[model samples]
Target: MAQLRQWATTLGFSQIGVADVDLSSAEPGLMAWLARGFHGEMRYMASHGLKRARPAELVPGTVRVITARMDYLPASVAAEGWQAVEWARLQRPDAAAVSMYARGRDYHKVLRARLQKLADQLAALIGPLGYRVFTDSAPVLEVELASRSGVGWRGKHTLLLSREAGSTFFLGEIYVDVPLPLTEPVTAHCGACRSCMDMCPTQAIVGERQVDARRCISYLTIEHDGPIPAELRPLMGNRIYGCDDCQLACPWNKFAQRARVPDFDVRPALNDPTLLQLWRWDEATFLRLTEGSPIRRIGHARWQRNIAVAMGNALAAWRDRVLTADEASLRAQMVQALQAWLAAPTVTGEAQAQVAEHVHWALAQQHAPQ
Candidate 1:
């Protein structure tokens, strides 16, 4: 077990644990969450059904699962009181706020490749091992697996929380037919803390350790397609991508660790970018800038739509504030950006029309709050 830890550390994984394939205890909760229709538009989650809880069923003959954790905070964010820095960025109405995790290379790619390498090394040692690697790519109960294997306890926000790394990390799993030694589970440390629920801008965290994906900002921005709900737009503030308010609010995050790998380093283009800067991007520019990035998955149209929503929120947030000469000029520039996108689009077909609708909504925020 200790030897496996060393190998994982060298591969940018922070920790590893062995878990039994049986997850019958989690099936009820999974079914309940699905029954309530809390999964929103992610039909895949429902389609998989209990296959997520039964690792052995997903991969035939699997008897044990290996869970791995990889910290992903950019090296630059290791400064003291980093949560304050993120809060300051979110407060700036005209500044585009992207989730820190998405500021670099796609996590799915980074974790998946490293996990495969780890699996390959294991196979070479064991001689023809049958195993499958996963990193948020399929129907699997990742948090349940990690929690059972002592990686971390599930927090009130339903994300894996670590005493050493907080929740600023990615998780991956390997299912194998071997019956490896099982690791003990950790006790929950959340106690009476409700910081994550209090910090949610949309009140998405409905109960202790229960989140409605329909209201989750991360799901709404990254997963859902078509029009964003009008009522939720104003509450989104300047967050143009996935949100981090819950993780930022958790007290344990003061201990968050920086990624040992450079793949999570923040891109120069995403660092404190303003709404106008991103709003002016043509489809080609968007693709070029987001190459090998998770943001590219949303395509240029959704990117523009998200920014338009933020731009509208910015206008509403500025309506009551006294403006300086530069502030007034900034406001005018934002208006021009919205109007220009409305008039001439760089996207085509349904994408262009959807973005156009968002632009019209953005242009209509004069007396409104958002």
Candidate 2:
């Protein structure tokens, strides 16, 4: 087990642990979350159903699950006071605040390839082994496995939280038939801390360790297709992709570690782009810029829809600010960009129409009553 840990560390994985395949204890919570329609438009989560909890059923002969954690905070985020920087970015109404995770190359690709390599190394060491690797895949209870395997305890926000890495890491799993020593689960440290729940802009974290994906900005912005709910759009603020508000509010995140791999570094295009700046990206530009990034999965139309919602929120947030000449000019430029998109002839397809509607709604917020 120690040798495997050393191998994982060398591969840029922050931690690795083993979990038994039986997850019957977690089934009830999964069912309850689904029954409440909290899964939102992510139908795959529902379709996977109990298979997520029964790893052996999903993958025959999978007696043990090997969970891995990879820290993904960009090397640039300072060891201390980085959350403050993120909070300040969120306050800037015109700046597009993408989730810290999506600013780099797609983690799904990074983790999958690395997990496969780790599997190969294991096979080399202990003769042939049967294993299947997964990263953010729907049919796996990733967080459940991670928590049970002592990678981290599940926090109030329902994300895996680590004392060493906070909640700022990506999780991957390797379902293997090998009988490995199970790692003991850790004690949770989120005692009496409601900061994550209180700080949610949309109150998506409804209860202790319970999140309603229907109201989650990350889900609404990234997973849901078609029009974003009118009520939630205004609350989304400048977040154009996934949200990091809950993680930022967590007290333990001061211990968040930086990525050892360069693959997770922030790209220039994703780093602190203004809404107006991102609003100007055509489909070709969007594709080119997000080529290896997970943001591209939502496609250009959803990207536009997300940015339009943020633009509207920016307009509302800026309405009360005493603007300098440059700030006023910036607001006008954003308004012009919104109007131009609204008037475009090609913004007529069903997907593009949703984006156009959002663009029109953004234009309307400029004069909406305070």
Candidate 3:
């Protein structure tokens, strides 16, 4: 077990644990959240039904599951400068705020390959194991399993939290038939800290360990399809990809560790990019830049839709401040991008009409009485 821990650490994993397949305790909460329609348009969460809690039922012969957590803070993030950098991004209305996690190579690819390698190493010792690896895949109760296995206690925000690593990490699981010894669960350490709840822009974290994903900015920007809710659009701030307010506000994150792998480093296009600059990218450019990114999964249409909201947020921010030539240049570039989008042959009927309306509104704002 000590050897496994050392090996996992060398592979960039912060911690590893073994959890039993019996997750009967979490079934009720999962059902209740689904019943409340908190999942919004993500029907798969409901579609999977109770199978998410019953690992053996989801995957036959799974007696034990090995869970791993890998810290994702970029190596480039200065120790004392993390919060300042994130706050600065939030203030720049023209800048698109992608969740720190998604700015890197798709974590799904990175974690899965490494996890399979770990499983292969185990097989070399024990010979012929029935195992399957998953990282954020559907039909998995990843966080619940990780917490139960002592990777960390569940935070008030409901994400698995570690004292040494906080919640800024990726989780991967290996379901196997072997009955590996289980790890001791950790006690919750949230105490009086409600910062994650208080800082949630959309009030998505309704209570301790409860999040209404329907109202989460991360859900709205990424998982959701169709029109974004009007009420929530303004609350999304400048986050064009995913929101990290809850995570950023947590005091425990002061202990968040940096990623050892270069694969988790920020891509230039996603780092400190202006809303107008990203909005200017055509479908081809979007595809080329986001080829290996999780953002690419949403495709170009949703990407533009997200950027349009940020552009709207930027316009709203500029309205409150005295404008400068640089700001005016940004607004002009936004207008030009909207016009280009309007002319695009592949723009969805719904998105095309929405873009046209936003363009007209933006143009009217330019000429409105000050």
Candidate 4:
């Protein structure tokens, strides 16, 4: 087991633990969460049923589960100003915000391949073994398994949290028939801290250890299809990808570890792009840049929809600048898009009202005395 841990750590996993097959204790909570309809459009969460909690039932012959966590904070992140940098991105209404995790190579591919390599190495040493590796796959309750295996405790934000590593890590698991020694569970230290709940912009974290997926920015921006809700669009601010306000507000994140791999580094295109700059990217540019990225999965239509919301927020923020622009071309372009959206029959009444209000505000700014 020590050898296995050493090998796993060398492959970028920060920690590993073994858990028994029984997860009956978590079934009720899972059923209740599903019953409440908090899973949103993720129907698979309900379809899997109790099979998610029972590792042996999901994968026959599985007697033990080995869980691993890999810290994902990029190495280039400034030591002292990281949190401030993240906060500033939200304030800049013109900048396009891609979630920190998706700025690099897709994690699904990265973690799964590394896990399979670890399994193969173990097989070579201990004889042929029956095992399967999973990373963020729908069939298992990842956070529950991680917590039970002593990888971390479930934080108030409902994400697996570790005192040493915080919640800024990706989890992976290997289900096996071998009886590996179980690791001791760690005591949770969240205590009276409710920063994650208080800082959620959309009030998604309704209670301690509970999140309403319908109101979560991450869920709205990523998992949701079709038009974004009008009331929530402005609240989304400049975030075009996923929201990290809950995790960022957690005090324990001061100890979050940085990734050792270069694959997690921020791409140049995602770092400091303006809202209009991203809005101008047609489908071709979008496909070309997001080639191997997880962002590509959202497709061009949703990508444009997110950017349009950000652009609307930017127009609201810089209304005065738009009015004073001597360049007729720039003014015409902005007005043209606003008018086009207003004319579109599919646009909701609420969206038309917002566009009209913004146009009126801009026109008023233009006629004001110098």
Off by over 4 Å in 1: 368-370
| Residue pairs with clashing backbones, model 4 | 94-275
lDDT of 2 by residue, 66-117 (tens): 9999999999788789999999999898899999999999999999999999
lDDT of 2 at 129: 85
Per-candidate RMSD, Å: 1.2, 1.2, 2.0, 4.8
The C-alpha stretches of model 2 lying farther than 4 A from their native spots are: 345-348
Candidate 4: where are CA atoms >4 Å away? Answer: 319-370
lDDT per residue (tens digit) for residues 210-281 in model 1: 899888888888998979899998889889899999999999999999998999999999988999999888
* Per-model TM against the reference: 0.98, 0.98, 0.95, 0.88
Q: Can you tell me which runs of candidate 3 are displaced by over 4 Å? A: 343-351, 354-370
Give candidate 2's TM-score: 0.98
lDDT of 3 at 118: 90
Error of 2 at 55 (Å): 0.4
lDDT of 4 at 97: 83
lDDT of 4 by residue, 26-129 (tens): 98988888888888887888888889999998889999999999988888888666878999988875578888888888888999999999999989989988
- In terms of TM-score, how similar is model 3 to the real structure? 0.95
